[model samples]
Target: MTAQTTPKPTESELEILQILWDKGSCTVREVHEVLEKNKDSGYTTTLKLMQIMHEKGLVARDTSSKTHIYRALVNQEKTQQHLVNKMIDNVFNGSAARLVMQALGNHTASKEEIDSIKKYLDELSNQ
Candidate 1:
């Protein structure tokens, strides 16, 4: 699906998507192992989630092998942009500047990240 048409993933689905996005492709067990490190969940639960994600068009499944491999179908950047835009609108009252200010105030950004933000701001001003 197009970025604009990508379905909003549930929190559970988003977690699975993140794993797929990071690892490129993985079997359910591989994903579950990573997930288990953070939270308590069953292998069957991960399998079911991946199946649901496949049906939702959020991920692609390769059934060529006995061990099915799944990969994220949605673009990572697009998903992040979508979620961030929604948060900015709903939580920050559509004020991107306020969102930026709040985030910077609450979080400790690395020097490199601060420099990157400044560079992005400079580019935006140039445009």
Candidate 2:
């Protein structure tokens, strides 16, 4: 079969993906438990979401034993980059500089964060 490329996940699906990214492979119950810590969600709701994610090619399931284990199919960095690009285009009119400016201006960055950003810029300048 040809490899399938899943579309960008929905907000709730992203939430589940975050958990899978952080925790690695998980069962439906395992995913449900972690989400429960943050939001009051039903286990079945989480299960259904994950099932749909499987159909969407966003997650892979292993049915080796009894409980099927699910893992995120997309790389976290790639997905984040894709989403950021979409946001920059849609919200900032394709200007990454504007996106950076809005982020820096609206959010308080620590001295360390500012220093890190400056260092990154310096490295980019040398190249």
| Tens digit per residue, CA lDDT, model 1, 1-127 | 6766677899999999999999999999999999999999999999999999899899999999999999999999988999999999999999999999999999999999999999999999999
| Clash counts for the predictions, in order | 0, 0
Q: Model 1 reaches what TM-score against the true structure? A: 0.93
lDDT of 2 by residue, 13-124 (tens): 9999999999999999999999999999998899999999999889999999899999999889988988999999999999999999999999999999999999999999
- Provide the global lDDT of candidate 1 against the true structure: 0.94
TM-score of each: 0.93, 0.90
Which residue ranges in model 2 land beyond 4 Å of their true spot?
1-4
Q: Residue 97 in candidate 2 has what lDDT?
A: 93
Those runs of model 1 whose alpha carbons end farther than 4 Å from true positions after fitting are: none
Candidate 1 lDDT for residue 79? 89
> Lowest-lDDT window of 10 residues in candidate 1?
1-10
RMSD of each: 1.2, 2.1
